[model samples]
Each structure stands twice: as structure tokens, then as C-alpha cells.
Target: MKTFTIKDNVKKFLTVLFWILIWQVVSLFTEEILFVSPFKVLPKIFENLGDLNFYQNLLSTVLKVSWGFILGLIAALFLGGLSYRFKVFQELISPLILFLKSVPVVSFIMLAWLFLSPQGIPVLISFIIVVPIVYLNFYEGLSRVDKSYLNMAEVFNVGLWKKVEYIYLPSVRGYLLSAVELSIGMAWKSGLAAEVITFPEFGLGALIYNSKLYLDTVNLFAYTIMAVVSCYILEKGVLYIIRRILK
Candidate 1:
């Protein structure tokens, strides 16, 4: 196990080094305004760490996206349950789910602009993006539960709580975890994309667009890095908490 871990760490290091080298080569060829070096961008990102606006925007994005994600997950589970219990509901909602799944996030953001407040846009977009993904996954998980176990439980007249404890929860745990993991990144990305277009008063996306507007390529790259790192951290943290709960 330790040897495998060392090999995996070495592979990751080499992968990152290869990308950094490519970035450095590209930056050398391009104008600073177009593509700043990763070294320069790293310092700029650290500088933002001291800036209060950074926290405010980061907090705002976090709150909005978290709210959206929770709402979407709940809605998906409720609707998925209904669909699983009644085939008609699934057939009726299939097209709508497909549309949400197929439509571009930017397109939804643009359409949403007509009615939604800039602040509300990111939240709504996140919710919209998350629902179909989690819904599909949860539905699949529920449907894929072992029918033999279910039949045996029925034959033995298993209590509702017992069935849920031994059957339903175990069956859906993987799907739920996977769904949440996938939806977290999508929700964050889609929320940020909406913020970029909407230019909300506070968000990493607003910072990114503002940096571009002012032609500050270093800060532009910095803010983009912050967004990526923050999103990745949130995904790991949420999954950790969720795994603990599911256990």
C-alpha cells in the first residue's frame, strides 16, 4: 500500500510538472497580457488571499451555491421517489429532465437574465444544473436495487424501517454519493458561469470578468485559480462529511 501510494504521488507530481512546463513555455511565447506565467499567477493569487473583497466574493458564491445544491438534491430525491413509485410521473417528466440535461448552462443563464435578479441568477442556475444530474443518478440507484432482496423482504413481511435500513439505504448510498460528487462541481461551475455573465456585485466570476475588463491578466489568472481551488476543496469537504453521515 505504501509503495502504491508513493507511485501515485510520483505520477501526480510528474503530471503537474508537465503541465507547469507547458504553461511556462506558452507564457514565454505569448504576451503577458494574453498569458502570464504560472509562477507570476501563483504570487498574484497569494496576494488576493489578503484582500477582503476576495473573502466576501468567495463567501457569497459559497452561500448561493450551497443553497442551490441542497435545494436541488431535496427536489431530486422527492421527485425521484415519485417517479420510482409511479411510472407515469417518470414518463411525463422525462422530456423536461432531458431538456435541462441537454441545454447549455450559458443559454439558461442568458434566458434567466430576463427575469431573475443578478444575485438570484447564480443560485437558480446552480439548482437547474444540479437537479437533472442527481435526479437521474438517484432514480437509477433506486431502480437498480436488488429485486430478489426486495421480494424476499416482502415474503418475510419486513417492516418499513427494516427494509429502509437494510435495503434502500445501502442500495442508494453509492449513487447518492456519486451524484453529490458530480453535482458539486457542476453546481459551482454553472453558478460561476452565471455570475460571469450576470456580473453580480460579489462573486469570483465577477472578479474574473472585472480583471479582464481592466486588462489585468495576472489577477484574471489569479481569480480563475482561486475559483478552481475553492471549488475542488468544497467538493472534497462535502463528500467527507457526507460519507461520515452515510456510514
Candidate 2:
């Protein structure tokens, strides 16, 4: 297993290196003003990393998106549970869920900007993108709970908590975890897109926007790398927590 893992890691590194080489070749061929070599971009990224404000901006962006994501997840779970329990409520909410899922993120961001402050836009956008996903996944999971297991629970006169623990929860754990993983990436992407458009004072999105305004290709690439890295780290962290809880 150890040998296989090591080989896998090496393969992944080689794949990444191969892509970077391809990118370098493409940039060289284009010789365009907007394109910066990955090597040059890496040094600029490191330079930005040394700045204290870089960390602050990264942290602030993460916090805003995460706060909205958690709140949205809680709201989704509550509503999904209620919908599962009540047929009328489900009927009423189904359209709204469908509408939210269908609307473009940019449309939501633009509409939200009218009523919300710049700082609030990212949170709202993140919430809008995440909530529907969670609601749908949880609702489906709840509905798909095995009838036999429920009947068995009834026969055993299992308490509400035990029924949830042994039946409902385990059945839904995979769905819930998948929803979380999917929403984390969506929240980050939508939130950052909101920041770029809204130009919040301290955010990765704002950094990207400013880089664009100045025609700073290296800075733009650096900020893009930062956003991607942040998203990757956040997803891994959320998955780690999910694993711990399921364990």
C-alpha cells in the first residue's frame, strides 16, 4: 500500500509538471501581453505571500464564504427535514428550490448587490448557490430511506434518536457529505466571483479585480492561484471533518 501510494503521488506530480510545461510552451508561442510564464507567476505569488495583507485578504474571503456556507447548510437541513415531514410544505417549497437552482449566480449577485452591502454580497451569493444543493440532496436522501428499516424501527419501538442514529442518519450520511463537498466549491467560486464584481475592500476577488484594472498579468495569475489553493484547502478540511463525524 505504501509503495502504491508513493507511486500515485509521483504520477500526480509528473502530471502537474507536464501541464506546466505545456502552459509554458503555449505562453511562449502566444507571446501575448496578457500571458505571463508560470515561472514568472510563481515568483510573484511568493512575493505576494510575504505580504501580511495577503494573508488577511485570503482569511477574510474564506471566512465570509464559510460563514454563509454553514448558515445555508443549517437552513437547508432544517427546511429539508420539515419538507420531508410535511407534504404541503414540500409542495410549496419545491418550486422555490427549482427556481433557485435554475437562476444564474451572476443574476443573484447583481440582484443582491442592490439591497446588500459589498461585504454582504459574497455571503449572500455563496448562500444562494449552496442552499439549494444541500436542500435537494438531503430531501432526496430522506425520501430514499428504506421502508423495511423504518418498519423494523417501528416493530422494535425504537426511540426517535435511535431511529435517526441507526437508520435515517447512516442512510443520509453519504448524501449529506456529498452535498457539503459540492457546496464548498460552489460557495468559494460564487463568493469570489461576487467579490471580483463587487470589489470588496479585502478579498481575493478584489485582488483579482485590481490586478485586472492595472493590467498586471502576473498578479492576476497569482491571485487566481491563491483562490484555487484556498478552495482546495477548504474542501479538504471540510471533507476531513465529515470523515471524523461519520467515524
Candidate 3:
């Protein structure tokens, strides 16, 4: 087992190294202004690390995306639970969820920009992007709840709180985690896109837009790396929280 784990780690490292090498070769062949190597991007990342506005932009983006995602998750839980109890409610909302899912994200961003402030556009777009996904995942989880367990709970006259804590929650735990993991990426991507289009006063997206405007490809790559790394950290943090709660 230890050998397999070590081998897997080495393989992953090799894969990353391979990509970095390819990136370096490509950058070398391209114009310096248009493409920068990994070495250049690293310095750009560090340069931004020392800037207050960079952190502010990053925090703004994170806050906007996180708020939308968290709100969507909460709504999904409430609606999923209610829909599980009321078929009519589910039927009524089904089409709305489908619409949200089917509509292109850019359409939402453009439409929302008309009615919302630049600051709120990202939040609204992220929320829209997340809602249907979480709703579907939560609903699926609710449907998969074991009927035998519910019947036993009813036979024993278990209270609502107890049933929720012991039965409903456990049934939905996996689905909720999956929803969070999946929706986070969607929320971040949609939120950033909205921010880019809206050009909010403060956000990573704005910084990215500015980088493109200035033709600063190095900073653009750096900002992208920062976003990817930040997203990964958030996902890992959520997983950690879930594990701690489960324990």
C-alpha cells in the first residue's frame, strides 16, 4: 500500500513537470509579450502577493462567489426538503430549475447586468449557476433515502428533529458534499465571468480584464494560477470541514 501511494505521488509529480516543460517550450517559441514561461508567471504571482489591491480583489471575488454558493446550498436544502414532502411544490419548481440549468450563463450575466448593480451581478449570476445543480443533487439524495428506515422511524414514533438528524441528514450528506464540490467551480466561474463583464470596482475578474487590456500576459497567467489555486484550496477546506463534522 505504501509503495502504491508513493508511486501515485511520483506519477502526479511527473505529470505536472511534463506540463510545465511543455509550457516553457511553447513560451520560448512565442513572443515574450504574448506568452510567458512558468518562471515569469511565478514572479508575477509573487509581485501581486505584495500588493494590497491584489488581496482586496481576491477577497472580493471569494466573498461574492462564496455568498452565492452558500445561499444556493441553503435554498436547495430548504426546497429539497419541502419538495420531498410536497409533490406539487416539486412539480411547480421543476420547470424553473430546468430553465436555470438550460440557459447559457452569459445570457444570465447580460440580462442581470441590466437590472443589477455591477457589484451584485456576479453574486446573482453565481447564484443562478448554482441553484439548479444543488437542487437536483439534494432532490436526488432525498429520493434515495431508504424507505425501510423511514418506515421504522414512523413505527417507532420518532420525532421530526430526530428523524432529520438520524435519517434525513445522513441520507443527504453525500449528495450535499457532492453538490458543494460541483457547484463551487460553477459559482466561481460564473461569478468571475459576470464580474469581468460588469467590471466591478474590486475583483479578481476586474484585474484579469485589466491585464488583458494592458496586454500583460504574464500577469494574466498569474491571475489565472491564483484563481485556480484559490479554488482548489476552498474545495479542500470544505472537504476538511465535512470530515471534521462527520467525525
In order, how many clashes per candidate?
0, 0, 0
Better of 1 and 3 by TM-score: 1
| lDDT score, candidate 3, position 213 | 92
Q: In TM-score terms, which candidate is top?
A: 2
TM-score of model number 3: 0.93
Model 2, runs deviating above 4 Å = none
The whole-model C-alpha lDDT of candidate 1 against the native structure comes to: 0.93
lDDT to native, each model? 0.93, 0.92, 0.89
When sorted by TM-score, best at the front, the candidate numbers are 2, 1, 3
In model 1, the Cα lDDT at residue 42 comes to 87
The estimated TM-scores of all candidates read 0.95, 0.97, 0.93
lDDT for 74 in candidate 2 is 88
Q: How many backbone clashes does candidate 1 have?
A: 0
44 in model 2: Cα distance from truth in Å? Answer: 1.1
Residue-wise C-alpha lDDT for candidate 1, range 1-247, written one tens digit per residue: 9999999999999999999899999999999999999999988888999999899999999999999998998899999999999999999999999999999888999999999899999999989988999999999999988999999999999998898789988999999999999999999999999998999999888998899899999999999989999999999998998899777
TM-score between model 2 and native: 0.97
Tens digits of per-residue lDDT for model 2, 4-123: 999999999999999999989988977556788998999998899999999999998999999999889889999999999998999999999999899999999889989999999999
